[model samples]
Target: MKTTVRRDVLTLPVAPTGPENPLPPLRPPGDPHTPDERAKNGLPRDMARQVGYEPLRSLLPVRLLDGYGRKRTDTPLGTLVIENGRLRATVLPGYGGRVHSLLHKPTGRELLYRNPVLQPAGFALNGAWFSGGIEWNIGATGHTTLSCAPVHAARVTAPDGGEMLRLWEWERLRDLPFQVDLWLPEDSDFLHVGVRIRNPHEKPAPVYWWSNMAVPEERRVLAPADEAWRFAHPGGLRRVPVPVSDGADRTYPPRSEYSADYFFDVPDGARRWIAALDEDGHGLVQTSTDLPRGRKLFVWGTGSGGRRWQEWLTEPGTGGYAEIQSGLARTQLEHVRLDAGTEFSWLESYGPLSARADLVHGDWADACAETRARLADALPGEAVDAAYVAWLARADTEPGEVLAVGSGWGALEVLRAEYKLPGTPFDESTLGTEQAPWLELLRSGAFPEPCEVAPPGPTLVSRNWRDMLETAPARPLTEYHLGVAQWHEGDRAQAVRSWERGLERALSRWPLLRCLAVADAVEGHLERAADRYAEAFDDLCQERRDDGAAWTAATAALGREAISGLLAADRPEAARAVWDRLHETTRAEGRFRLVEAQIRYAEGDIAAVRAVFDEGFEAADLREGAEPLGDLWAAATGGEEIPARYDFRLRP
Candidate 1:
């Protein structure tokens, strides 16, 4: 057992900050508590470092979860590497306490698809979620809002005379508490995993938890369930049979054209275990202790979208992998309702399993037998020895010294001493030197020249800036910026044209579609705006329709945007239709009520607008944030000024 604090990392500024620690950890005025209560890139005031929160739904799709909000001058980060007779485990203290890697020493196998880089792609909702290793999902799934912030980590001796890495955090999303204890029994092969979560609120909250494990692709996924359900990307559930879906056994990998992401439910009156076996006999099994658990598999398909996501998540070689996820109860869609302050806990054990070929297609009985055999083989001889060296993004810069490095899996690579590298010490530059300048500008919070778009106002922005740039940038981002700039310059007619072109390149970007719809409305293309807003709203609803309480807030904001977009274009009937559809799920939501009031005010129905404010919203309502709503209510009654821009801002 060893702990390391890289002094060099201390010199790395522009990260976490704390109060009374040189850096002010300045939060916006009057906006103190953010999602995760917003831990800036700083160490916890106490030894038990707490993870930060993020917005339930972030407006900006930037990766702020990486402690970028924290000032580097505030706190120190460290890593812990623990090893025993046969297995080695590594945990990153600063980065969400995620288990970086688990190595089976005898076979020299990196048990997990250990990512060699800390490169974060703008994929996850709150951003800063990476591939490989294991990740913890609390609150509203999709890689927790605190996926990158530090969690409380402690090195404690297990009751069974083994080393335990105890990590815990107060997940702010639902005001719930979570704790994960990783125990490696002395001379044992498995890592005993224990998890406990408690809802602190007086009332019940919809709690979601998923332990996402990234393993090699094409691994045989074995579960006790006979029937599996494919979870659709937007947010729906369709039942699919085990080992096959549309003429393909998703469990066997080599994914479909797009992406194969779905949950495998444990059949009633079945055993509780999910295992994955690679072609090389070495396997990993996650077994629970009669707890309500479910399994999931995600294989990024072979299509352009799939390939692009693969490249985005990792530096090649560490490319293809599937996430063997374990959920608390059921799918992310139908999440379990955790009673207020009711402490829920479970224990799961994971270890190496090299079973016979015959057991590959067998049921739970045979799988358990093989797993037991593997565990028996894992127990060491009389002499039990422990202690090994592993690095936590620590690299010693020296030529050919046989560094026991890697992202804590194997000696992947090493940074020459004092060599400061971007990404992580484990990462090699994959986007190449050509993309370096573009990436640098993006990181510096600046648009890469062509992406310079001013806000919509009397001010004339750089319209069609891509055409003016000397380099002739070919990226979809170029068009996205061009469209924004054109729209800001009051050229909505041209902005719609540019955004449509941009959407062709960045097809998955929903925000672009939303912006395009707004531009269409501004250009008096009411029919186009109505149609586009409907599509955008559908897309948004698909992804977030079932994220529990989070959905309520998200849909409130989304409904307001959709309905307002339609109303702005003078398509009152179309706006009503959108409102009815949203009412199916987000019925009588406060934000929509605000939008309804605004619509009536726009229609010269002052009484209706006043009546809405008279029916006051609760403090917990999502519409409470826009304090200006009250003033808008007053204006409708008191004959005060009502600016049309307020509709676009949705500030009401």
Candidate 2:
């Protein structure tokens, strides 16, 4: 099957321009902030200053006349010449073949230019000239083929009856065909440009495209992705890496400051798929199908210093390229070039998702998934699975899948035990070290002799008890503890028998003697492991109180029981009451808003959940150091196909 390529057309009509005069230099935005402000507020200041850059000058002295009048310029970047109040910019040698600003003849509004290199030093205007009009062509095929060309200048007219100046000269390649046309709208807010490319090759070609523009930092680039790889340049020399750990996989490095000349690349076949985001995740530029994957994926940002000839190539600290390569560094070049006659195309549609704030979480998630899917497709199948497994293993603490019958439960208990320990306290000397400290504290009764007003609590009271146990430690006691640990490891029946024997021996010594609250909690956890929700809830609750950490502990146990009841009985309403109480208590205690959101979602209140997200977004610190709630929310709301815990599958 052959892949057919097409372009979607969009038109923008320019509004009527007021009477024009000799235009003054372009002005910057109203509230132009410094680099520090941009960094502190997460804004992109480079783009906002594009218009105010130096005007383009022409290399050769030239004069052109349209019905409006005559225009002339000398120098390189380009020159602003007007005919009958109509304005057109032509190349002037000193101006460097680049056109900085082109204003409407009547309105004075700026003309928009879109290119893959979002920011290029300059443009090459007038590469090839035919009689009566100018033809602009770009080499697309592997060979030099000018298959597509813009309509001759004679056939095109400025929107306000102004002269159209040829901005850059383009060369057509044989195998690839690319062309862009400027359409001045008679009545519109935007200057419309249409781009087209055609590839008739038989093999897949890797390409990168981007519409390089200087936009404001307040505007956010919105593309699909969980995370973005970001690199920031502080001095214009070395690029730093900042890894966004919040489920976002993009690799952008973090730096303390930013200079100009930052390059970012996207991969091929992913056209207009990535987005440029302002500090608040707002969209700045949208791409069309004409954007080259190689160019679009590879993004470059130059600072005001670079814009001026003063610091060109001066290496202003660490400003370098920030590009997303199609493949790794080694294979990128091969990926960009397509075989002859093979068809390749990139279609990107851009628009604003937000007016003030940056892209939202849903938007970010969608973007992340799209980018990840592309990356996955790029990798080999075996490699993909292996990578995924590695990722899961890194995230998991247990030896086996959390749902595995014997192994999984056992692993969980071992993990919990390890978590409870103070930190790697299981070595040969661990027991001795732990005992020595307590023994010293106990023999001296240092814990009982308090410098503070309140006496030691039951924990300190139980210090003596622990000391006695340590002093007269026996094999049976050790065996009992091991048996209890085994019970926690999911050897339930064995644990019961061992505990019974230990209980008998302990009772023989003292009728009131019992095991630790931790033992009870473990037993309770195991009972619930067999679908005994009520029993488990009761056990955990009792253990919580017995452990003298009742308030929060009981609340946690109640929350789990409520969720379990909801899952078991399928009665959302009853579960909602429990969720509400938990919400109230947690809010009162100022903790776990995400948990509250999960509970609200379980109660079928999506708005409440979203509201919680909004609140969390405002209180950015809350999201820091918090566990993920997406999985729990999915399970509790019946959206997940798998259980949250491994309890059900192991039951006989």
Computed on alpha carbons, the lDDT of every model, listed in order, comes to 0.53, 0.29
**Which parts of model 2 have CA positions greater than 4 angstroms off?**
1-177, 197-210, 216-219, 227-283, 290-354, 358-652
Best model number under TM-score: 1
Model 2 — which ten-residue stretch has the worst lDDT?
Answer: 61-70
Off by over 4 Å in 1: 1-77, 361-652
Cα lDDT tens digits, model 2, 1-652, are: 1111111122211111111111111111111111222333332233223212221221111111100111112212212232223333221211222223334445453332211111111111211111101112233111111111111111123333332222221221122233222323223222233333334344543332223332322222334322232323331122222123334323331221222222233434443343344344333233333234322122222322222211111123323323221111111111234455443332222222223232232354454454334333433234423423332222212121110011021122222233221111112221232143234343543322222221111111122233343343333443344343343334556545554565555412110012222233344543232233333333333333232233443444345444544444555554455555553444433234544665676677787876665454211112111224444445454564432221111111
Best by lDDT: 1
- Give the alpha carbon lDDT tens digit for every residue of 255-346 in model 1: 46546466676765554566778765567776655554677877666654456456545555655877888887555443466676576766
Model 1 clashes, total count? 20
Give candidate 1's error at residue 495 in angstroms.
31
